[model samples]
Target: MPHDDDHVPRRRARSVFVDITPLRESPAFAKLWTGTAVAQIGAQVTIVAVGLHVYALTESTLAVSFVALWALGPMILAGFVGGALADTYDRRRVALVTAIVAWVSISVMATIAFLDVSVTWPYYALAAVNAAAATILGATRGAILPRLLSPQLLPAAAALSGITMGLAITVGPAVAGVLVASVGFPWTYLLDAVLFTGAFLGILSLPTLTPDGPRRALGLDSVLESLRFLRHAPNVRATFVWDLIAMILGSPRVVFPAAGALVLGGGPITVGILTAAFAVGALLSGLFSGPLGAVRLQGRAVTLAVAAFGACTALFGVVLLGTGLIVGPGAPGEPVVPAIVLACIALAGTGAADNVSAVFRTTILQTAAPDDVRGRMQGLFYVVVAGGPRIGDLVAGGLATLIALWAPPLIGGILILGIMLVLVRTARGFMRYDAHAPTP
Candidate 1:
């Protein structure tokens, strides 16, 4: 009895770390994960480079934020259309084609940068194209995961995906910062173009994945079906709404460039560190995600995680406010070491909380939605995931123009907490949601 008891506790302890069984059990998943992990780093670099480049040119926070705004419309349309196509066609094919298109777009971006094109419009147009293609690829790839792994291992898969994202952001932005400061913008963009080839390999290695149900034509009817399903599925809808609340109110990324230049004063390097801080938190959380897989009350987990995210974001805002008060406004050449450290700590906390929310949210969506409509659902998921932050960028940039730089996050964080509290309390179904008996 003593030996058995000790074994049980030991097993429980081990379970608290990330489960690697999914990687070992699914070779295809392993390839996809590895390839994506590498590719995303490049993607992150480009993301930071673009913001820095735009800000360098226009010297406006709103201009940097508009990068996301430019891509938002195309992203939404592509997400819906891609989801329908994923249902209608082989998911592997859809992912592969889109990956190619995205890769090409990145190359075009690099070419423009390489040729020393002074025009900014080409950058925006190409970025929109890249965002649209990526949205489609993301939707298709998300839907394909279930086909690769068993239902029981979905949580592990989600956890692993979190780790991938964590690694990407943690390394990508930091690298972009150093590269942009050292080699200039074209080289930074070119690196992304080179790294993007990994995605092609990942998609090519995957086996064909088709929808389990009868083939649905790609059009308005299919899109309407997904929307109709979402309308009735309060739990799933709540997840979407809750994420939007958290992202729109809590995201402070738009202000990072300004914060680095004017508030914290380390220039691109400081901006990179600030961006990487959040990813570091996420990476740590994912590394120890063993306990998360065992969580049955995912709805509650999501709520708690998002609440933490809001609180941390608010703290970050406070740090920024404090720094602004100490330094006053206008670009400072010297760095505020203490304030930067505090802000990074807060951002890291926010990242950890956001990753936790994401793991649960993704698991809920994949498990709750039926296989037949999974593609469409994943498409919607892409929209919320991609569009929410863009919307936040707009809000943050616009608010900063009127108020202090730190106001958006401070005000937004409070709104997130309040809104989420009301949303969770009223949605009794979500609070009581059980993973084993997922309802969508």
Candidate 2:
């Protein structure tokens, strides 16, 4: 209930996702959105695949997180390249190229999963490659939107993206877990390969979108220029930092896999259910999110949504605490829980809350940032939005390895709550982000 959105007048805004808003009414935008939805769903499949594979191999949560740990470097590289490409070349082409790369990476992963490859290092390598390519596609996709949709409908478009996120996270992961459990990791991953085609078609079919920035010929200099622009661009800088702090401290995804095996007892099924639960919350939020489409103060929206997210994490930690109390703390190899079914419900609540925060943060970046710098801005955005959660993964993995599995969330939940409060109080511009007069 605690939220920064309380300040936005509770005006009843019309719901638009049931039918295409004027923004996506354009055939190009519809195609682009369809492609993004396909890509998101594939990404979800791979995400669950990686988690299950790691656990299946090592039976260690820490080992699973190494997938995220390895991703840090490639993610950094891909972000820069992808963001720069978004500014320089045709954005659709950039997306296409990355999509191809990601597709190949996932294909390799599928092959390995089918083989039951005992070699863990190769799995990590392939995963990092997949993540890096995904980074490029993700950043450019965001940058491409302004060209696809008119400004008037940007907010609605963003909410629609939230619905996509909801579907990808909720539907994809749930289906993935079932598929992996019923068939195997290879089959789950193969389905992802088939879906990847949708993203390729989506990006390729879109109307040609020319570069808006002064044609700075592509190279190292162009990439460096983006870094420099980021430094000078105060709002852009603030936005990324805000995202970093919010995600690094707040994201609890790292713990979900471990929670499934250790506390919940259902293993991969629990992991998938927990992930889907988060998406459910997000998709449901879109129902009341019509007003968010008309929101003028996005900075406040980010703050409130993030705070709510932190509270949910804390609540998730409480769920862990409850399990520990009921099961009596790792009395053996795995802690026992009375009713894991209810725990999945708690995790789903956490998922929904987090998605609400994502809608606002994404809107801030898409609407506030200029086209010239939007790609790099999105690249940096990925570093945090995509990157911070990985750091949390490492933190969770390492801490879980050293201590009890429950240790990370109890600690992380508190850290998220504290840091978000401090940052919101300090950063007034973000706190005062009026959508009518965007600063970035």
Candidate 3:
């Protein structure tokens, strides 16, 4: 492990802005980043638009949860299988194929909307297909990244990834709201299909990246090997546990549709703003992430950041609770300016804190794992990243349906705070973990 003092000199020279060293040193990384950014923006648009569309059709939060529920199984399967494939084959080809699959899925979704399909099953099925493809693409891309940059630059690269995500959610949802409101679902889905072509440019430009060690057949054993590796790898495993807690307990995105419709109002626009506010906060954090690169005790930083995330989520719940008591539910399509502002502020806080946690967690995983198992490791990471939120969606939706709309986030956030406190006490080794050593 590098001592805290080792970073002081570098810290002094670092700017307040996010370091662009990864981009400057590697042209391939830059192109890949830019292309992925463009494609991810479109993906976010579809995500937001889908939630709004589902809510409009059913007028039920539980129904919106079903969208995620439908996709969960496929996502999990794809993540494991994709990870195995990434290890056994050319990563560039795997990514390209997955991208094509995702593109076709989105195109089909657009066509269904254009045909004025009233049933929700078609949308749900298409979403599952898209989700599966996206999981593979994400896993392959993560494996490809380490090959493109030096070990020291991984933190900056993760920060850049955060910026990509930030821009995607920020711009995409905001655009989706306007486009959906004006041009309707067909056009919104169509636009996503159009923007998805950007992913191809990135994958196509990449050189072939085969796994470094002995290649094995793609099967259950291949997936199990990655799982077995995690059993002995406490540091890497710790990151996954922390992220699952943060995402499953603290993530509040599922309730946005309900909040917009029943509580905060302004319909899709309010939903967009609420979602975008989180991304805006993430964007600002990435912009100012230079100082974070100097931190040696990365594990401690991740814990602290997730704690902040829980607090902010709780704050958001409080805002919703207060708004319900005072302002009450307004007419559909009406904007509640004060409530929206407060909620955005709270959501943005969660976003900022979550972004910080993500940067370190990603850096740790990328640095600790060997190239041979990195794909499978990233695949499991994808499962947590994709599955945790789906479970959160189910929890938020089910609780909001059974109790008050504000109850799920309020309860979940409190649970996260309690669990994290307990975790930090018991997991002493994880707390003292250092970035320089990169142990797993």
Q: Quick one: RMSD of model 3? A: 4.9
Spell out the clash pairs found in candidate 3. Answer: none
Span of 10 residues, lowest total lDDT, candidate 1: 418-427
Kindly list the per-residue Cα lDDT of model 2 for residues 1-440, writing each as its tens digit.
Answer: 74767644432233433325743367877887887788788888788778888888899977986787788899988888778888888887888888888889889888887787887898789889988988888899888887777765777777778888788877777778789889988888889888888887678877676677578787889878778877776666765665666566656676776677766666766665676676777787765566666767777677666666667666777777777666664432443444455655655655655666676677777877788878877887777766677666667778767876666666776776777788678877778877777776
| lDDT at 5, model 3 | 100
After superposition, candidate 2 runs with Cα above 4 Å error:
1-19, 22-24, 50-66, 107-124, 181-187, 256-271, 331-346, 397-407, 422-424
Error of model 2, residue 193, in angstroms = 2.2
Residues 155-197, candidate 1: write the lDDT tens digits.
8888889998899877888799899999999999999999988
Quantify all predictions' global Cα lDDT against the true fold.
Answer: 0.87, 0.74, 0.88
All candidates in order of TM-score, best leading: 1, 3, 2
Ranking the candidates on lDDT from highest down gives 3, 1, 2
Please state every model's RMSD to the true fold in angstroms. 3.0, 5.7, 4.9
TM-score of each model, in listed order: 0.89, 0.83, 0.88
Q: Which stretches of candidate 3 lie over 4 Å from their true place?
A: 1-14, 49-66, 111-121, 181-186, 257-269, 324-339, 398-403
Q: Is candidate 1 or candidate 2 better by lDDT?
A: 1
List model 3 lDDT by residue over 1-440, tens digit each: 99999999777666778999999999889988988999999998998888888888889877887888899899999989999999999999999999999999999999989998878888889999999999999998998999999878888999999999998877887799899999999999999999999998888899989899987998999998999999999999989999988887876787888888888888877886897799899999998888888888888888889888888888889988988887655654567798899999988888899999999998888888888998998889999998888777778878888988788778888888788777778888888888888888
